[model samples]
Target: MKHWIHNKLAKVPAGIVIAALATAWALGAVLNEHGMARQDRHEVVRMTEKMKTVCVGRFLLDLPKEAQITFSTPRIDGFTVVIFPETLDEFQTRLAEREALIKAKPDRLGGDRNLEVAKEVRGDGGMTGKLLVHSRAVKEGTASNGLEIERYRHEGVAVEALMHGNGVSVNLASDFYFPDMVGNVLKLAVKLVPNPENKVPAEPGFCMDGAYLRDPLTADQLEQITMFARLPSNPDIRFLLILAAGLQPDKDGLIERDAATKSQFSPTERMRFSRLRAAPRTIGGIYGEEVVKRVHELNDSIVYSFWWEVAGTTDNIFVPHIVFQMDTGEGDHGPVPSSLSEGAAMGMWDRISSSIRVRPTQPPERVAAESPPTPLGSYAWAGERCPESGWWQCSDGGNGIGVLGGQRQYIRKGERMPQALLLPPQTLWEKLRGVQPSFESKTQTSWKLVDKRSRKRVPSPLPLAQATPVAAAGITSAGTGPSVMEQQGVAVGSFAATGLPCPASGWWLCDDPRALDGTRWFARGSLLPPATFALPPGGFSRSANSAKSIERRGAWRLVRLADAPEQAASDDNGKLA
Candidate 1:
């Protein structure tokens, strides 16, 4: 090739060859420029072809019809349902890419099912399932059957699925008759404005088991709209259930972990149960554990905390809770007593609790097929979802910068409440009556006893008793205050022992106004030690001191004459220590 070029150059005249070569070089450059321009034009044309204005919703479309838009303002954290115009195309493109990359894929849905489901989501706003009303049906199995879902020509499939990350989720597609399900999903991510009454650090993680209403509110306007201040007269009812996990069992068969449960013993809070009860529960055909604690809130409204640990959920957990909020009548703040009647409420709890179940196992392995709507992953890569993930300046239609404004919402949702509270209805009347059930007799009684001096059924003020000595186990390491479990048995005659059956207040503490003896005498808050209080206290002292007073024992200062303070045995007759 070099020799041929030299020969050709040699044959031409020096000026002519130089002129010809320059002309040839110029022509080549022109052709190259035209080729590049054609390629760029083709690229632009192809990009435009892939994108077209898509109908997202009524009064809403992609690329803005004359500069219009639709979306939530001041978007909430952890709860976003925006369908960007670009999502469908991106989803199709990315799904193909993922299908190639995903090696350990689970069974996939049918191609027809995928196409049908995608069409439904685009044509309809969102879809639920047929199990909406059948609260008894198990979800895990119902969810796994994709292609098996019967599809109707006039309507969407009874069951539809979307690809969410690595998992292929089968959703029971419906008309969303049970829209209140949003409350369950939303609360998991909703922000609880700081409250002076309750001090929850953040929103708790929870799940919802929603049942579709046979007859739901049909206001099309309200379908897409939501009220920020309060729930509807009857939002689609659901169980805003929170599940708490138990720690490994210790020697006493107790899982001693931080409960972080809401404080039920507040000054204004009323106690309905004398002590924690570990009763057996058989809910939803799943037998497991149960614990019930009832209390009345500051406004005399009653609510209780129910904790259940269904059996066989996992080996690591003794009982995985299915916590629930059961309100009786209208609470102090809300207008509705409950979405259901008292009978209905009980029925719902039992039915749903009975329905609470573990995720069903998958069918045997079989050759899989492809299915739709981002056919296999979480939210779309960018666009509408970018803001939620702090990914700005991303996708073709996004930076999400204009949408997020300068204030990015930080997520604190999904953090378990540490505890949940519920109230039963009858509590209001009881609160109005201003009476509590005694632990001893388990009967309704007055908050105050028959005053010894006043001869009235009012709390008698008791004088602050002098500090008594506490046993080693009773005194906590710091001794700052009483601990929940510190206990020591005191042995004294019934005469000097404190009353056995506890009062409605549930505590024998000196600070409790209900427990005080009209300031004449009261239980000790802090004590030194038993030997110290005894003076080697004058025990079985000079006779005639038969007046036996109830003396509380231990750091908790249990208000019972169960056992009397340490005292020297009476010589022949009773003596006071």
Candidate 2:
């Protein structure tokens, strides 16, 4: 058979023989590549156990029970948390290597990249801490022709403080345009308490009698928090979570659809923008959009990135933008090989993304009226259920109601707070909020309970001549005239005023002193009517001629969409009858 084949090949043209061999080699290469991709495509992910909840900013997300989580507010507008699938010691090795590489970079561009300041200091509560300051000097050289000035300097100074206690360490970093922040940064470091639980301790932990690190960023156009996790069985597989509140939004408090997302990519990025999945998704109670793309590079390696964002509003801290990115591959710039199959990566994303939700401040069945009243100065987010009905002052800084001088508002318990537009500063007000050149950004306001009296209260029966002015008695309308929707044309929290047309058709919560009937269905474009409360039979009977009932023009807030499944479960009329 070999002799016969050789004779046949001799009879064939040399060119044809060479062509056949080339074709076979090409076919084999294609098959090898196809097999590699298939291996990733069919990888299976088995979530063997129930998920555990971890708090990230104003929301909660479920993860594998074995995942180790750490929380940090690395930036004023950002919160970051890292979850390790393996033991902390194993992850530390990877981090140590990365840090060493960063430290080895040679100084260039007429600037020094040396660690100029490193010292150990004792913080409050006997906590030991290390202060690190890396400074790059401002370099000024003679102009090219000695006519102009040539200057080079890094943008800002960074002060990092690491506190060690309770077998855990807390890191806090601050960036300042000047070096004057060192003193304040030290002050902040001493006040930090490293509690592994990341919760407000019932009693002091390892820190002094001061506030632990929480949401301390009060700057406008600044909102960020990040969370990262990896699989314990496969530390190479990782997940990242990011939240940003300063992204600009439309009138409805949603990110400006495609334009905003497209702007995230530069010219080179646009070329690699291999879209995989892009659609609308609602995580927690906020309405937002998402885009998932697979990155195919020149080296034939691949990466899958996910982007999601919601509108920034004056109602809650869970506004602006959020992202969930996953990496299932080896690091250290080695050969790009994913640890998990593509199917496994997508399956994990679906499981965790679906579990994202606003952390419940109260039980679902707990009625606002029945719950204990929230005291003055208590803080609440916009989307959260109002703990007490009264006046709330927006402390989110120069945004929301402040743009129109209506920062303090009357909001009833059980009613959703509204949203407002935070006009970009035309002056130096930008520096006041930390980040200058502030653009139009939507962020949830941290509202504080200021008053405990509602507008249009049910007055006691008194003779007309003796009736005193509500304001004269130190009780005035907390209602700031028009709603944020009416004044700023931006609904703070998807809410509509009583006289305004309903922004959306849904169950609207009545902002009444007494939550009358909780929520009622309302149609879009229809005027939200007033909520009437009947007076108790003999509670206010100074005379038989006294008023028997009172009507309050309360603002109506959209609680649920008209298409919710529970809409059909109720048979009562869609009014507070």
Candidate 3:
């Protein structure tokens, strides 16, 4: 077989071999391009999917009250719910229903049907206590195949219950086809007793003064009071308990009196006396023996201390001044609170507490100084000035001097001024020279002549003769060679002989001359120069090169060859390189 392959390879032409290599290279290039294109398409799809998920989450969160009240927000944060039955019979019934539903559509739900019935129990049955019940349906592999398949299509439902001293606090969080199931249950409860006060039994627990204390107390207070109550009893115990409860000594000094009484007795005897003092006491004095200390302690525990320097006061009440603070993890800190509620005191407290957190001290004020003025004429460039000849001029179409009136005027390049005040030949010559002459002079000459036919006195042809010669020379010079001025026709002796005078405004003539019927004339007033020279050299060439260099330098390039490889991998894996 090897000998046969060698024979066939030898018979292949060199051109054919080269063509085959080229074709393989082309195929590889096409495949690479296709792979890159495919990767980009996948990236777009993935980003679209992520955006859809985010949009769904936002839509759920931003729903109006009516919508949110009906359907709970999507569970971006992990949360589970368990339903507890009040009695064993109720538990058995609910269990049986769950089992039947699972059996009816095993593919639509999940649970362990054969598990012990008592093991699924939650709460203390009829006893008042909190308990957590696990949903056999939501367990791994327990959901019906059909329900599990729809996990991505919809959220599911779960239930939970906590038995408080007064009643039960039921939580129904669902992850099912409809999120409104839990909401519906809550709505039913709300309809039964729309008002919480009405729904919650007023006398569920003993409402004794101290009993109410335990009911509204915070976790810290509850722990502290429970520990204090469990302490060894003594005659001074009542005083201590009262103090712990925030009650101050009465005007009769009953608390101190009780303390003194306990000091003289033995520990056992003091314990007995303390129990006797536990009963409420009254004193016949200016101030009655009240539980002022107990109220103070309660207030101290509930009211967070803060420095509230405010602008005003009313009704002898300190309107709380609030300051808010947020942690962004970037070390940036500032006060966020701006306003306080008015009308309802309770509303004001809620707003202030929720919006502001007390800080140890105020932040220092930021002081910024004014920036210095920019340097004068910093943007000025070269070739921006007018030339000599007392004519106003500007590269841009802006104000320039009026040659005749000595006033500032505006003119554009390539536009001719009126012939009423035509520029003199000498003045035109000087302007073309681009510099003031060493010797400046003005001359005017007149001559008399006889008409060929009438033989009458008339202006001589001398002015015309001299002007004609100069005009011819100018035309020749303009066409053939370099010269200070180019002329196209005879210069009249009127003002051409005497150079045009410079106005007070200092206008300068442009180098270019206007031509009319072969008569070349200089502009009498200053001109607005061309914004850009038609033919520029030197510096312009350098500017073009600089621009090209900047473009070349600005082009993006991969810093490392390995970066390309990494990028390719990342693209394939849908990750940032």
Candidate 4:
């Protein structure tokens, strides 16, 4: 019967048979590519594997071993870069030290003591989702160089990635990277297809792509939020987002102010899309606000990730948060659907968030003895409230005028956190001097920084002042060492001629006689009388203080910095005033 059938079928058209075979091959390819069941099966297999776990004092997470791990230090003003121990024993030892340090003084420097203790505290509500961040330009880049990979794993699967951290502040940025796998992760890219009418600027990464996160998500806010790179050539593939988790002050509502800030969206997208509601969610029993807002237009293929840390016991503590954002498009134009559905994406998020458990991670056995803390940078206050002010201090600008990490920023007056810019606090040390943070310079100048280690940094002649001892040391205006006032083109001659007005940490501020407002930095108690008139700060030979007081011009007030007196004075007669 088979032979007869074959003989009869041999008369059939060869073209028809060939077309049938080709059609079957094509159909099989499409099914394998888009088949969702096969993908779900892969997910089950991934879940079956052991999950790698890491602890943050209060919260614990069990992520896939195959996923990369990066843990950073927490920050108050900006993102902190933490250093992870390379060896297992080192990891355990370092974590133990971190826990002890917070418990030791909580407010070791002048940072928010409450925030320091937040991580150890547990959340009252249930768990939420998985994510990561790249929120602001905190300049954590300082610690990014030559970073060591922090590894973790439960089963055979393991992932390795760099971790940036600082020891000063509690805030940090943790970045997680996962290798491209068919079952679990997807890669996404953002691109600019030059418009036929206008040309896209050739600027590298300067586009207003991610800066919109810095502002409030007000009513119908359209911000130019793009992914890291320009859209890839093939738009069919899914776009994946990297996760960044960190801490920020819970400003009650969405970091909102009275007025609406400006928008930052691209012209092609035109407008942004958003949907916000009180989705009071629970994560690891921590009750926090679930603020879900889209900072992009619906027409644009993108996914937004945002989370907040559960409220803690004190106002000083900042909450932890997760921010994940990605854009996917079906074609060069139109709203591109994410490869992961809303529900699937949420589950992926929950897979991470729900895994948070309040437990301690086992550190390496017989952890190494803790190393003494190293002082790296020099920081001065600029604004009114120091970091110790807790929620009250406005970080809108930096702390009153501060200097560290190779950049000069405004820091709070009286605010001193030498370790705050830990993207490797050493970055600042390297900035002032060479690699030796504790090294001292013998140069006699007004621009020098003397750390507690007796190490001093004196750069070449510049506008900045040299390091001065906190003691009420006299500034010999007649001598060679120029005073800080002189360098600024102004002079603060002591009327008493007994001692200089500003101490090492003391700053001379322009004051108003009527309101008594000026750039003065006085400690709690000082013998120096408040001079109604202060000579303007500059190298000018003689200039009168801008004051209405009858006291004759050039008669300036001298106030001792009671707190500063404790700081060791440099061997070189460094001058602040």
Candidate 5:
């Protein structure tokens, strides 16, 4: 009985221990849940109150991999360009200095702790956001003892600094490229407007073409956008400048021929025009030339290629060409634009550099076979022989081979047979017919306008005369005189009736039959509405209006129609009746 009592006591102790452990586990879980809830709440509050400001910084420095650089100049108002260092140690020092500077000038920096953290954080997207740096490097070759010892090449690099609002957003991004020269920095001031809640990414005051432009201004209305170009940056990148301009036709058709010819337009307008013209052609030409020169200097095999587009009012057409010129006898090839086949250009590049290999991603697997065998025999393979059923063959014979016994067979019984073949299926002989692969045939030619003074070539604008009208009826015509109706505007319409001859130099005016109650009128003027007028078997011209009579000149005769009162007096005096 004593032993049994001892056993029961042992069981009781074990049960008590298990209960205590369960209670402790439950308490620990509750504490963990509470801590997580608090963290989530904090994050939500921080993001909700965050104010976003886009800062763009241009730095003339070599960027080291994974380097964290910061800028803390008081002069920087809206945007900031933080220069990255080439070495790890330099980056560290710069980062430390930036922190000290920020702490020193907290008021100028503003009250956003999240933004501050972003500015201070390191690593990709850690604090400030992602870093987009552009660089261009040029090296020169050297010649010794009457021989070329070394030639130095010039390179430019551009970098974009992006800062986030909540320290968690994808930082601003920019298109980066290498410049042709060194130590050149372009700075711009931009204003940004944030949403009412201020939690969203700061948007620029104006809608520009690309995201690289700076954004989101403060109440003081200050913002700065900066860009840097240096060597070691990607060469394929490009910058797009969005410009707005008032285009007015030259009334006199005379370009100013004076010393201050450039001042014909306002400074703003001139700058805008220059940027628009330069953005595509100038930048590309300058950079491409620099790249070629640099490659030559290094004695490395280099090739140059270029492709461009001629954008019409209706459609964008591509003109592609490849020029292979090499520095070290390594021949240059193409500067193909994106409009051309990227595969073809890459193939050319591969030929120049055998070490280069292009592995194209597998084409998407066809989800469904192309338009299942057309029921009407219009399908691409409809005329081919059906391997499964030897009986079903095109009228041209087996697989449209058009050979052997000339027995024409189409559909047999109720079974559908192949129809006529539109084109012969590609064969090995067809592919091998051209040894050169017709590369030059792919070349395209387009017309471009060249500025006389600048000697710059730009895609030409379509002429008004060559422009096809939208409506077939033709544009409306304005009156001969400068009436309000003429001034208001006239639509160009059909020219079926007006037998008026085409003008020699300036424009001619004519009224449509619809407007003149089936009567055609012709007049001479610089501007008039468009219409058709009926002429005599020959052509005619009208004289200016006079006080007495209306005179009409035609190939047939010169006739004058006088008032009716004069004719009435002649008849009354004939017989005194």
Candidate 6:
């Protein structure tokens, strides 16, 4: 039967066949064009000057505030980006009822020869659904035994789920892909939350539904919305705004240049196309290319179109391809001149497109996470318990005059104050003499508290001093071979200068007779910081009482050894060091 039909067709002339095919194609194209919805020439376009903030997906943008907005759902995979003009509570309640209705239906796997239920998934945000995989058994080349060999073709899988977040809900579905595209799309939906109160995790992720969610697809995803103007006067005039973001078309579809590519059109088609403007433009910090065109249809109708698109790639969640498009034509038809003037459409496009921007996403800190305050300027002395938890500044400048890290340390409350390294007198002299001095010594020092309100506690620096102290060996004078007292063989009444390392562990008496702390325990090798005096109940202003008013520099005389009987006697007077 096939040979007989082919023999009959081979007798027909090639020119006649070509003409018939061309006629059919031309007839179809003409019918399709005529059947399309046309713009009503009488209807005029109008717009309000007021604008409002519209939150769609994870982004926020300004729209005509007074423009009536109606929500519609388009079949989009991976994400459902939409703006519900209703209150969050209202939307949630309605969404819950819809979910309940779906749940009431009995589950039954349909008996189909070519389709099978691969798996079912249930999760939060109404993510309860099943995946369907397409399969078909086909007979292949026969085997040597004269038996037919059968093979199965796995034609991918598909899934759909309801995702709830950001005050609205949408049904998320995915197109069929070999490696369980349904599961991947569901994973993205499961991570979606309505206004998430958590930090955005590192990438292979994106912000959606007012929260950051992991996007399993390595490919860039795009979503778009077509906003139609409601003009009662010109009901048929189609003036709509199209806003889209994320992935965009490459060279084809809406992204292709219409007027510039007239070379691809016939002479008659080229006569009806005109390019008004095409250039690089920047809106809301996003660099994108723009194009404006006028289309003159064969039916004597005119249409205006505008397009702006940003360049982007995968893994760039922060910088997605933002598209702002406007058209004055019928929805189904290619383009038609609308009652709205081209000038007004351009003005509206500029006003709305310039306002496109990524919404600010700042994670808020919980009030309970804040730490207790540590008053600055609170002072603690060496060998005494720290009064507060915070960074403390030591009065003793460690040997090198003003070293960076050594002068400050973070200390917690109730911890014993460790001594600071003393700045040797000889070291100071060397510095005064324009010479660099180096030394390491620990001496009892006064510490002033400092803190940041945002940080509850400051971390301690690298090993400065031991938590437990061992018996100290004798101290040598700074830059000097030996102290005069050490040479004279006197263990008691040894002199130690302020800001200098202590030569011995003993009860050191302040040389100043009127000082509040007459004598204090000194650990050998600890720096002898200036003696401190208790200030009034209310701390004096810095202008009224300088740092000298609270602390004074004076020589310290080792009155008694720390392990001696006299040293124990000093502790009996409630002065434990």
RMSD of each: 33.2, 21.4, 45.7, 26.5, 33.5, 26.6
Local distance difference test scores for all models: 0.28, 0.53, 0.24, 0.32, 0.27, 0.52
For TM-score, candidate 2 versus 5, the one ahead is 2
Candidate with best lDDT: 2
Give candidate 1's total backbone clashes. 47
Model 3 weakest 10-residue run by lDDT = 443-452
Q: Which stretches of candidate 2 lie over 4 Å from their true place?
A: 1-45, 48-50, 66-73, 77-193, 198-223, 246-274, 294-303, 311-316, 329-331, 334-342, 362-577
lDDT of 6: 0.52
Judge candidate 2 against the unseen true structure and give its global Cα lDDT, from 0 to 1.
Answer: 0.53
lDDT of 6 at 141: 50
Per-residue lDDT for 501-520 in model 1, tens only? Answer: 22111123333243333222
Q: Once model 5 is optimally superposed onto the true structure by TM-score, how far is the C-alpha of residue 449 displaced, in angstroms?
A: 13
lDDT of 4 by residue, 245-320 (tens): 2323346543232112223434544345454333656666655555444445455456544443443332212123
**TM-score, each model?**
0.22, 0.36, 0.15, 0.25, 0.19, 0.39
lDDT agreement of model 3 with the native? 0.24
Query: What are the clash counts of all predictions, listed in order?
Result: 47, 18, 39, 71, 58, 8
Higher-ranked by lDDT: 2 or 3: 2
Error of 3 at 55 (Å): 30
TM-score leader: 6
Model 3 agreement with the true structure over 198-286: per-residue lDDT tens digits: 11223211011111111222212111111011111111111011011212213334444545765997766444321211223222111
Ten contiguous residues with the weakest lDDT in model 6:
568-577
Whole-structure CA lDDT of model 4: 0.32
TM-score of 6: 0.39
Q: Write down the TM-score for model 4.
A: 0.25
